[model samples]
Target: MFEQSKKYFSYILNPMELLRTKKVLQVNPTVASPRAEPEEIKIFVFDYNAAQADVRELKTVPECFAFLDSPKTTWLNVDGLRKVDVEKICAHYGIHYLITEDILSIGQRPKMDEIDGLVFCLLNMMYFNEKDSAVEIEQISIVLGKNFVISFQEDAAKDVFNPLRDRLKISGSKVRQNGADYLFYSLIDMIVDNYFVVMEKLGEKIEGLEEDIVRNANTRTLAKINMLRKEMIVLKRSIAPVRELVNGILRSDSDLIEERTEKYFKDVYDHILQANELAENYRDMMMNLNDLYLSNVNLKMNEVMKVMAVVTCLLAPATVIGGIFGMNFENMKWLHTNTTFIIAAFAMIGIPLIMIRIFRKRGWF
Candidate 1:
């Protein structure tokens, strides 16, 4: 046992052996796969008021700007930031260069800033991708001005703002009755509400892992636990900043956020707080799951050791007896008689049986 422990320490202390055996790297690379293609830009314009609404798809920047001067609240939704000259649109709205830069950058953290009567906010939109069985994150940049709101997204294929558009189609919708600020609040509210969907999927995954840890803990399960832990970290990183952003908006003195709309912002803030708390809770649960998985692995190792030790114990006496009788001694009592050989055979058999019985009574095997 001492020699075995010495060899274990030697293996551990050797730098080359440690380097070869340990998994020392963990990374999630951001490069796109070879099969992926660049996405095209899609523009959606919504012009609405309490009395009337118009929705259309625009192909050019000039067409998008046509509704900008209208008295009604106009919302321009731009999806897929690539290949489009965002500077021209920003120039048309008097948007600052820094704000335009933030809009084009795909991975900016959530933040809110007000400049010269314009309110700019950056947010992370998260959802579970069924095809990949992973959480997908997209950046959403919103600019709220005097009579228009422009939203920029990295993907042209999907968004959560469809419900608000559906509501706008109805006559006398609250979103239509209010100004651009209310529309801004509704967009933010929809984004915040979608967080719950992502959280629910995460919760389900955690529960499934818990069951797996209890039923069978193996290398695959361990890898899954680590994956989930990393995902939870990502989720927390995505949410914590948004919570701060919403809090900043709620406390800001910007005139772009009206007094009546401040209450709606507060509601959005509360939702973010709830989502943040849920993320923290899930993180704690993942830590516990990791601990549980390690404990199960150790327990399995202990069981294997017990079985091996029992086998060794059962064979020990028989080996000793056989070794003793096999020695050469001409004058020995067992050397001259066939009975002696028979007695030795019985002794070997009897000793092992006795030991096995004793071990059984002690519940050692």
Candidate 2:
């Protein structure tokens, strides 16, 4: 666990690695990898309604135009972002250049905006990287159009959309029966649901750290506490703005979001609200943990001091007797006599015994 924590913090210290498009990692664009492993841009399409679904991967940016005007609800899941490809797809889909800029910008805060006929949402999608036992954030920017929704992710492979895609594949499912708004809701709902997963893992770690602090608080424990506090802050930042994003969807007057889908988005709003509360609680708990660590350290220090005081008291009689016997005067009683020396030795040992007995009786360490 300590090793895992060290590795995790190494990633945390480098904010650029977490916030920017992964340009160095090789991830298969067709399969989902951890959020850290996306290198190239890829696009996936899920087009469906109540009757049937068309699922395929696009090799070029222009392929997306075919679904732009299709009667079926179309969801373009862009895995990674190349500036040129993003500009081309956004232009073809009638998306504003500014929204495209937001997509290209990898670190936008969680927010919602309405431009012309499109409703745009940008939020961080949280993932727990099991390999390093860390929380990873990927920015997802979604644009809801007349009959289409486009999701842009900085990572090429990592997402919480498989189950949602599975629902789209299932005939007669609510996702298939509903319009594009419901599909949009499902996408946001999946993102919100993953928030709980990541938070639950954080809660478990917090609980574990609390126990560890109580049992044995050490420097490593302090490090872990600091690390957790940092993680909590990140979670809070990512989660707090999302409440507004979800609420914006609920309060949006965009025609892209139909009346019937408001309830689904409302459900998502409730979930984000719950996640927000959890983040706040974790933040408070982290502060409490720091205090607890200091208290424990002080308590341990006091224990050591108490033991030293008791030992010093026990040795005081011996020190005084030895000091008396060392006198240079020839008239000193036990200076040269064996029996007197033995008596002095016994007295030195016996006095400390008595003092210890009295001390124990008084409950003084």
Candidate 3:
């Protein structure tokens, strides 16, 4: 009994060495912000009006329900998704279950969905971490209501909407004076602007990969290129949806959106188009790099084969002579004599050297 207890203790201490303990340990999920837990959701309401934009934090879903009908354009910024209370909030605001499902699911493609009296837009905002050589993407969902804009994010961390916040804070910023449409455009414009920053970093990575391939196009370069290609693919997936979404928004007659704000959205729409085009170009360039590396490898292999062929050609005569003399040539007594052996050996040596010179002259070496 004591021995069995000791064995179990040892197994617990060193599970890797124990039998039936082959399952891999699960890694913890990455926490994007301090407020990553589901219980704490921070909701900020900013109502844009002719006088001053009133900004306040809502403590309950009831507060949001009460504040949606004000004459000012209200912006509801919800900063976490784990709160079970969000369902009540969504219900109160008339946001459908499908849209709420999209809010909870992070992997949804960047897209826009609209129903009667609401336009739903999902945008992926990414930040590049150079030290880690990775990018972190967060979902930003915009609910454009009649007199309000509701923005939902996965985690309550730093977001690109701060620029719009600053604009609202200042007296002359476009966000302060414009309707919900301009605020919508400003949020999207901010997102698109940040994308360029990420792309510039991506451009730098592509440049580095180019240099790496030229210097030493090894397996590592191939892997790097594959990684970049995947990232570009994701970028394309994210950007392409917005292209159609923005176009739809532009074409639709949403009474919630003011006519003055169309140009701002068009500006963002053009940027999205440019981003999609750039991603395609990068995809092609990375492919070219892959082809370039393959070509280099083939050339190297050909050089190696050429060297081996030249060496074989030089040694062929020597090999044949040695083989003929090695067997018992008893018919000729001179074959066994020292003088004949020396003569045959010299001929073997001379023949190979002549072959070597011929090959060199022909530039085969």
lDDT of 1 by residue, 281-348 (tens): 99999999999999999999999999898888778877887788778877766567879878878887
Q: Write the per-residue lDDT of candidate 2 for residues 1-365, one digit (tens) a residue.
A: 99889756856875554442243233353443333434567889989888889999988888888898899999999987777788889989889988887777645668999997899999888887766556778888989998888998876567789888888888978888888888888888889899999999998999999999999999789868866766776688788998899888888888788887888888898888898888888899999999999999999999999999989988999999888887788886556766987888899999999999999899987
Model 3 deviation from native, Cα RMSD in Å: 8.8
TM-score of each: 0.85, 0.87, 0.81
What value of lDDT does candidate 1 attain over all alpha carbons?
0.81
lDDT of residue 305 for candidate 1: 98
- For residues 145-249, write the lDDT of model 3, one tens digit per residue: 877888888665658777678778777776777788777777778887888788888889999888888887776677577667766765666667878878888
Query: lDDT values of the candidates?
Result: 0.81, 0.83, 0.76
Candidate 3 lDDT for residue 47: 78
| Candidate 1 global TM-score | 0.85
How many residue pairs of model 2 clash at the backbone? Answer: 0
